[model samples]
Target: MVLVSYILAPTLAFCNSYGTGLTDWNLSSTYGKIGLFIIASLVGSDGGVMAGLAACGVMMSIVSTAADLMQDFKIGYLTLSSAKSMFVSQLMGTAMGCVIAPLTFWLFWTAFEVGSPDSPYKAPYAVIYREMAILGIEGFLELPKHCLALYCGFFVGALLVNLLRDVTPKKISQFIPIPMVMAVPFYIGAYFTIDMFVGTVILFIWERINRKDAEDYAGAIASGLICGDGIWTIPSAILLIFRINPPICMYFGPSASS
Candidate 1:
């Protein structure tokens, strides 16, 4: 699996990087699924799951790193920074992340019910990826009724959407929803969709009020929001490590009578 990944990683990573540059969306998980299925099918049932997972990890890392490096390169270009410095920094960051990410995950895993249905951090892709591996090993016989058909239908639809977007006039193409962006809600849920919509609305209103300022500060504002949200997790993790729970727990659901 590792050997196969090494042979294929460069091509797959280049494709992923190009797609990321165009869309700002890394489809590493999509590439990982390809690796998962291929490795699982080859290895057969006995050790298939483990082999498949390892292949998936390798493919995902290579693809995501390439895409991220390209993104950073773009940033460096825009900011007139040194390419050599950026490359070194990217390598250092990736090396540190390899160590830090697992430890951070361990902290969260020990601190909270990470993958549980009721957990705030459900790690939905983990479930999806595991299921993909199982499907690869077990074959399509285990799939629910109409599942394969649905998958095929959507596959065709996505291709058609892209084809239309490519051939259509720019004005029409601009309004056409990206299949990749639309697919995100299927796995991650609509909460993020709502967040994006709210953010867009805010930005639109800000632009209406002050177009120049919005154009100037929009990226910085968005980055700050994203960084702030990510940084909050450090404190949250510390609080959880200390067994300090929030005083107020809120839950919302349909009425019992309903």
Candidate 2:
């Protein structure tokens, strides 16, 4: 499985990096699912679960790292920074993350009801990836009726959309839907989609009011929001660890008495 991952990593990373450049969306987990299916099928049911998960981890790391490095490189290029310095910084960050990420996950896991249906961190992708591994071990014949057909149809449709986008004029291509962006809501639910939509509306209004300012400060504004969201999570997690729940809980659902 390691050998297979090494062999596939370069191509997968290159594709993922290019896609990230185009759409600012990383599909590394999608590629990881492909790895999971392949490795699980090859290992068979006996121990396919572990092998498939291991392969998925290897593939996702390679693809995600490549995409992140490329994005940083793009920033360095725009700011006239040295490639060597950017590479070194990325290496250091990745090394730190290797230690920090798992520990942070452990903190969350201990503090919260992670992966539970009612938990905020439902970890939908983990369930999807595990199901893919099982499906691989069980073989394609186990797929529900018309599921494979639906998959093939969507695959072909995505290819056709890309082809059209590439061949069309810039104005038309700009309006064309990106398959990667579309797939996000399907996998992760529409909550983030709603957030994105709200952001887009805000940006549009800003651009209409002050085009130059919007163009100049848009990246900074977006980065601040993203960083703030991430940083806020630390305090939330710490509060949870201390058993301090928020005073107000908002629940949106049908009433049981209805």
Candidate 3:
């Protein structure tokens, strides 16, 4: 989404700003390639106090997300969701990304460089995930334990909600709603707020304000989501450390090329 907007916004604004003419897809891909590094950093790391400094890529990645969001809102046609929700979404995405992000790094390192000890594929995240995957207790595999802890919290919270509703019963559940019983709430939900829902509010606002012409609004909202919610996904990649600069460039050895 950010890819599409970062591409189109400049081009459309450029056409309006200048006299250039080009198809939207062409423009988007071009910018996406150019900004891939920044995108990488933001996804890979979300700016921890000390640890993030070592991850230059990840720190840059977080800055890029926040910077782009503020700037994009100027041209953004949809601005319904409050800034607070956007912030929460960013953190939520980061936590979820902490799980999904490493998978990509691992896939590349494990599959392509299998049995190559000195391969450039070994980076920070690759090492961590390789360790974890070997341990077999990380990412989605940890979901059961995560869910159990979450359900414990929810059960406690819901018990309180239930007891109160029994007494007053005037939609006390409305205030602290009983979660989907069969569905079973997960710990991630406690933190995440399940807010792919915010986009609906933004879209509805765009419909009313922009006369239902949602093209730019779509771009704006998407840019917000990517830079906003999708910031730390790449750090998961960087955490793996894929030697973007080949070992040959860094002068390791001849087999490094192989």
Best by lDDT: 2
Residue-level lDDT tens digits of model 1 in 8-68: 9889899788776654567888888888988988887998888888899999999999999
TM values, all candidates? 0.65, 0.68, 0.24
lDDT for 86 (candidate 3): 65
Every candidate's lDDT: 0.83, 0.84, 0.44
Of the pair 2 and 3, which is ahead by TM-score?
2
Give me the runs in candidate 1 sitting further than 4 Å from their true place: 7-30, 74-80, 91-135, 227-258
Q: Order the candidates by TM-score, highest first.
A: 2, 1, 3
Q: Which has the higher TM-score value, candidate number 1 or candidate number 3? A: 1
Over the stretch 16-85, how does candidate 3's per-residue lDDT look in tens digits?
2121111111122222322333333344433221222223233334444444344433333255556666
- Candidate number achieving the greatest TM-score relative to the actual structure: 2
What are the root-mean-square deviations of the candidates from the true structure over C-alphas?
7.8, 7.5, 21.4
Better of 1 and 2 by lDDT: 2
| Model 1: lDDT to the true structure | 0.83
* 1-258: candidate 2 lDDT, tens digit per residue: 789887998899998998776546678888888888888988989989888988999999999999999889867865679999999999999999999999999999999999999999999988888887888888677878998899999999999998999999998899999886777778767655765676689899999999999987776676565445543557778998999988998777768844
lDDT of 1 at 72: 91
Residue runs of model 2 more than 4 Å from their true location after superposition: 19-27, 74-80, 91-132, 227-258
TM-score of 1: 0.65
